[model samples]
Target: MLRARPKGRPKATDVELVDVVVGAPDAGHVRVENLVMSVEPYMRGRMGGEATYAEPYPIGEPMLAPTVGRVTASADDTVPVGALVLHERGWREHALVPASECRIVAHDDLPPVVHLGLLGIPGMTAWIGAERIARIETGDVVFVSSAAGAVGSTVVQIAKLRGATVIASAGSREKAALARDLGADIAFDYHDGRVTDLLRDALAQVGASGLDVYFDNVGGDHLEAAIRVINDHARIALCGMISIYNAETPLPGPSNLIKLIWRRARMEGFLLRDHLDARGEFEAQMATWIRMGAIRPVHTEFAGGVAGAWDAFLGMLDGTATGKAVVPLGTLGAGTHGGNDSLDKEANR
Candidate 1:
């Protein structure tokens, strides 16, 4: 049971928290004590009544995402009672879920949060886009938008692993520098005037005619520039368009899409849900890379109880969060539940 409404964006709907009890696990069901909650842009879409990759959050319904939790009880013998699992539990202290919906996580040296991030959706999205959609190869000039964000950063690392020369874009100069530090051959500030000119120079600096593959995250203008700068027979993985996400009005199609016809470029868009069946294989590969120190996971954590979950979610919507924004309910934030309350109070003073 919880005491108050979940904190989130001003525009957020379907937000609340209060008295709830977990029932004993039934056949194929497992009860979990959630330890970490993943705050992501897709969740924001659900809050806004926006129809993106999934359905909008129903009013008064509990919001859910990929959460790491400890199994307190299990009805299914296949899932042990003490195992750690990741399931589509919401911003709550506990959950009861189906056994098939959860995956056991066993990487001890790696932080459990990585299972919500690098070793999870962000990592897999980058891997599939680079390996399958874009078909990244040695000597290929790959351009990635939102290079400093979770999925974008993962793409940069995996593309580098594939021996491709990487060019990345970020909204700020500081983020651009961070991308460069993360092995990007070139980094550009997207907020600067004349993005196309800036990108042309980046391509020219690399002694390339045009980009062979593009990992797109910011789709509007960035997509426009990419269309103009792609080589013949290029490939593009349309990840997401954060720029148009908040627009009250509808967005127009890419103006430079004609390049696709002229250059015979292949462009495709994907949703993470489509790849859920292959979670085991993706986890195996990502865990190896994380354990090998070949990849680094970054996150911005917001310390707040269940009440703070709403605010942390809205923070991501406002572009205030750098990496993954998370809320550790019951342990941090405005509520006084335990030892975490003292830290929250002292910080306030």
Candidate 2:
């Protein structure tokens, strides 16, 4: 529970992890021992106390996030005891989840963490952005922004799998190299210069036509660049605008947005929750890609329980951890600290 809402950047003191004892589950409810908890960029918007296709996190309440766990006890037959499941009542070691909100996903071949990263929202998000939103095609020239992050990196591999020429952008040279290692045909650092010029030159170097599709994860400068060089009828999947996630107010709009009209291009934003209708198909295809070594899950795992959640979340907000930020909430990892009051006082400063 937050003692008070944040004034600027959030602090460890703003959040306190209170213990909630989990008694036996009621009928139709399953008690789960959480294994892995997810911390993503969207949670930052939730903490801002404004609704953006979602509601604000209520103060003095147990925080909510997608969690993968094992059913220690079950009151419903569909979710039997000892089955692994995914639920949204994370932020803690144990949770009582409604059977409807919990999905059984116990597979010995695939670890539970995969269900939270590549095989989960991040992977599905990339697939939706490419196939559904951007409509990537064979022989198409594609550009992905924030290409070192979870979703953008997955977008790179998925584009390669679909036989498209993948152009990936990262914030630093090291990240750009990682993008190239992940099969991006061309990887450039967005910080090098105006990304517009870089995209144009990279296209020339590769002897490819202008971008046919753009998997846009960084919106400000990257969006402008993509709009500037996009081919006629090119489509853009507006996945995120992380460059401005911390801005106090609206920043400047892309100067080249008019290119959308000039080139007859299309840009659309999407949330993976709205596209779950494709989950069954995405899961099967993603499994195949994994078996064929087409897609690799990239993420950072923080080995602290719920007590470390506030710090782990802060680390993600500061861009310290690459890919998806995951915290392993083992039973022992949970009981190490009392709450934010126990956090290193220096972290609060």
Among the numbered candidates, top TM-score falls to 2
Where model 1 places Cα greater than 4 Å from the true spot, the runs are: 1-14, 48-52, 106-109, 330-349
Candidate 1 per-residue lDDT, tens place, 4-71, comes to: 23233344444544545456788999988777787777765666554656876666667777788788
Query: How does each model score on TM-score?
Result: 0.87, 0.92
lDDT of the candidates, in the order given: 0.77, 0.82
All candidates: CA RMSD (Å): 4.8, 4.2
Candidate 2: list runs displaced more than 4 Å. Answer: 106-108, 331-349
lDDT of 2 by residue, 169-253 (tens): 9878988998999999999987788888899988987798799998888788788877888899999898988888888888998
